[model samples]
Target: MATTDDSFNGLTEYCEDCDLETLHEVSVQIRTESTKEENAQFSREPYRVCECQRCGNRSSQRMNNA
Candidate 1:
């Protein structure tokens, strides 16, 4: 059997902008649902997000389902 790490891998500080406890901009893929109801939901896609380690500032870009 394969391990969890083999399936899902995370890039730690992959971006040069991200420093130790500092504000930085990075891109990440996220899975999301379209609606609360399963029937109404559509599909999942990758999203770009920005995060700050020091101030804990996090934001996400608008979903583009196309």
Candidate 2:
């Protein structure tokens, strides 16, 4: 349940500095784009707020759990 470095592990992605596409640190996030039903329920689309752990460059993507 715990990691030594406490760094969040994630899928591979392009990092300008890494070039090898290293891991990213997913941090706090915000959401938008609610569906009609979800809007009524006050739901919001998920988005990941991440940064390249190796370079600190930031990026974002839809938080698709699947």
Candidate 3:
């Protein structure tokens, strides 16, 4: 299950500003979508928000839970 809280550290990704791969602070957040029913049902999709340690650049991408 994906958690509601954010997590940080131990993540590395490419930074455009730095022009290299660097460490990052990563957090996970749930993206919810509602169904067309009267009482809507929500589905959870998780994504990661990453901030580069070197240049402080930030980016986001969808996380595959499979």
Candidate 2: segments with Cα more than 4 A from true spot: 1-12, 33-43, 64-66
* Residue 14, candidate 1: C-alpha displacement in angstroms: 20
lDDT of 2 at 44: 56
Candidate 2 residue lDDT tens string, 8-29: 5635566777776667666656
lDDT ranking, high to low = 3, 2, 1
Per-residue C-alpha lDDT of model 1 across residues 1-66, encoded as one tens digit per residue: 111222223222323344343434557676655666674335566787766544556666656757
Best by TM-score: 3
CA lDDT, every model vs. true structure: 0.50, 0.62, 0.68
Q: What shift in Å separates residue 32 of candidate 2 from its native position after superposition?
A: 3.9
By summed lDDT, the worst window of 10 consecutive residues in model 3 runs over: 1-10
Q: How high a TM-score does candidate 1 get? A: 0.41
Give the Å shift of residue 49 in candidate 1. 1.0
TM-score of each: 0.41, 0.44, 0.55
For model 1, which pairs clash?
A: none
| lDDT: the better of candidates 2 and 3 | 3
